[model samples]
Target: MGEVIRVAVVGKGGSGKSTVAGTLSRLVARQGRKTLALDSDPMPGLALSLGLGHITEPMLTAAVEKDLNGRWQLKKGIGGARAVSQFSIEGPDGVRFLQFGKADELGLGTMFASVSGFGQVVHRIAEDGVLSDWSIIGDLSAGTRQTAYDWAPYADTYLVVVEPTWKSVLTGRRIVRLAEQRGAEHIHLIANKIESNGDLDVIEERMDLAARCVISRDPMVTTADAAGVALIDHAPESSAVASIASLAEGLEGD
Candidate 1:
C-alpha cells in the first residue's frame, strides 16, 4: 500500500462502521497524512461519529453544475483538490470532511442535487491524479445499495465491518462478495464489537473469512456516543480506539 489508502467502510447499520471510519481517518491524519473523511449516508451518522455533529447542509451542491446534456458535474475546473479546499469541512486532527446532504422530511428529494454532486465528486477523485497522495476514507450507507451501485469508486480496499450477530455477518459477507465482483484489489473483514475470543470466532466461522483486525466492545464507545463526540476525543486511550489506531497503522504502513 502507498501513503494514500482509499478505503470504503461498509456494513450493516449499527455495526460500528462509522466509528471505524471516523477514528481511522483521524488517526491517519495524526500520522501526518492528509486525510479526507467522506459521509455518503444521507442520514447524518458519520458526522456525529466524526464529532461534526448534525451537518445537515448539502455541501457539494455549489460545487456542481448542469452540462448541456443536463447532467450534473464538478463545474469547469473543480476537481478533487479544488473540491476539498472549497467544500470540505475541517475537523479535529486536521481531517477534512465532505458529505452528501441529509434527507429532510420530504425524503431524499430535497437533496437530490447534492447526492448527484457527491457521486460525481467521488468518481472524479478516483480518476483525477491531482490528489494521488491524499488518503480518502468513505463511510458508505448501510446495506448493499451503495456497494451494488458503485458508490465507492475511489476505494481500492473495502473494509467490511461485521459484528457477532448473524445479520451483521450476512451483510458483511454480501459486501465482500460485491467488492470481489467489482474487481477490488483488497477486501478485509473488520470484526467489530467483539466481546471476547468467542465473538471473534463466531464472526469468522459464520462469515467464512478471517478478520484483518478486531475492535473490542468497549464501554467507552457507548460513553462517547452518549456524549455526542468522537471516540478519539472521548477516550483516546480506550481499547476500541487502540484497535482502530492499529488498524489505521497497518493499512497506511502497508
Candidate 2:
C-alpha cells in the first residue's frame, strides 16, 4: 500500500526459491524500481545466485540481535533510523542487498532463532520506511516451518516457486496454506525448471494455486551458476530471464 512492495519467496528445499528471489529482484530493478533483496535464509543462496558472493559481514547483525532481545531503543527518530540505513548494501545492479549469514546448527539450536533476528531486521526496515521507495524481496528458507512465523507477516505478496515434480507441488501447496495463515494478501505460484508447456499445465492442475509464470529449464542458468554470476547479468536474453521479467510486471499490476 505504501511505496515499497514487499515480496517473499517460499517453497521446499532445492525448489529454486532463491533463484526466483534473485531473478525477481533484478526484474524489479530493470523496471526502474529501487529494490532490496533480503537474504533471510541462514544458508543463503541469494547472494551467490545474484553473483554478490558470500558476504560474511552483514551490516546490522548485532543491531538485529539487540532488537530481537528488545534491548535496542526505538526512539522517535534516532537509533532505529540510523540502524536501518547502516544495515543495507548496494549491489552492482543498484539493488540493495542484505544477508543473515549461514545458520550454524550446532551453535544455534534452531533456524527459528536466526529468523527471529531476521524478522526484527525486516521489521525495522519496513517501519523506518528507508526502503519505502523500493521493493523488498525476501529470499526465505525452504519450507514454511523455518521462516513462516517470522517473515510471512511482512510480505505483501508471496511468490512460491515450485518445479513440476510431485514433491515440489506438494510443497507449494503447503507454503500457500502457510502464507494464507500468515495474512499474506496476494499469493502466486511459479513453475520453474519447466520442460514444456505441458509441464506448466500439469503444475496448474496438480496445485491449487494461481499460476502466474512458468520458466522453462535454461542451460544458461546452469552456466551462470557455475560461473558465479547473476543470471540476468550473465544471460539477459535467456528465456528464463524473460519469464521472470513478465512475472515482475504481473506483480506490479496486481
Candidate 3:
C-alpha cells in the first residue's frame, strides 16, 4: 500500500559512488521515508560513510549456494525482501544498511553470489512490490561488474556518479547505456567532487548525459573523512551536504 523506489548508485572507481549512495539514502530518510542502503560492493564502503560498521545478520549473498551439479542457486534464508529488517543494520535517521558478502580477495564466487542476490531483489520487488515504503539505494561494485553481472534491473533507477575525468565520464556513459539495455526505467547522472564551475563545465562539455544533481567539492567532506564521522552530522551546512540533501525532493518523482 506504499511506494518504494530502488536506486542503485554506480560509476568508475574513485568516482565517489559510495559517497553519493550513502548521502542520498540519509537525505531520503530525513524526509520521513524509510530507506535501505544496500551495499552490493564487495569492498563494502557505504557502511562507514553512513557512520556505521558491522552487520547484525547474515549477508544477502549468503543465501546463494552451490547445488550438487555445481550450479549456484538461492536457498531460502534471505528470501522475502519484505523482511529485510531481520537482516539489515539500522543507520542514521531512517536508513538501514545491508552488504553482500565481504571478499578477502577478488574472485568469481563473491561476484556471482552478489549478482544472484540482486536478481532475487528484482524478482521479489517486481512480483509483489513487497518492499513498500522503503527506498532502496544500492552502492554497486565499481566499473562493469554490474554490467558483467547483468544487475541493472535490481534498481528501478540508477544514479551514475560522474566526476571530472575522462575515465569517469566514459564509464558513466557505458553504465547509462548498459542499464537502459537491461531495462532500467531511469538512469540519471550525479556529478560529484566538483571543485569549481570549471570542473562542472568539463563534465557538461564532453558528456551527452546531463547531471541531475551536482555535489560540490567541500573541505568539510575531507575533514569528515579523516575524522571518520558522518558528513551530515559532522558538517550539516557544508556545500556537499546541502547539494545532496536537495536531491531528496525529486527522488521518487521520476
TM-scores for every candidate against the unseen true structure = 0.94, 0.85, 0.85
TM-score-wise, the better of 1 and 3 is 1
**Tens digits of per-residue lDDT for model 2, 1-254:** 22356888888888888878898887777667877788877675898777687666644544433345555333334343364466667776778787654665324423443444456667766565555576878888888774556564457888889998999988888888877777778888888899888888889998876588888999998888788778888998999889988887778766
Could you tell me which 10 consecutive residues in candidate 1 have the lowest summed lDDT?
104-113
Query: Candidate 3, residues 1-254: lDDT per residue as tens digits?
Result: 12456888899988888777888788888777878887777775787678785342336556677779876666755554743655566888868777666665435666677556656765565566666666788888899777656553457788888999999989888887888777888878889899889888888776677778998877887887777677777888888888887776667577
Which sequence of candidate numbers ranks them by lDDT, best first? 1, 3, 2
* Best-performing candidate as measured by TM-score: 1
What would the TM-score be for candidate 1 when compared with the true structure?
Answer: 0.94
Model 1, residue 29: displacement in angstroms? Answer: 0.3
Off by over 4 Å in 3: 1-3, 54-58, 61-66, 76-78, 105-123
Please report the candidate that would top lDDT against the real structure: 1
RMSD of each: 1.9, 3.6, 3.1
Instruction: Report lDDT (Cα) of residue 61, candidate 3.
Output: 57
Candidate 3: residue 29 Cα off by (Å): 1.3
lDDT of 3 at 245: 72
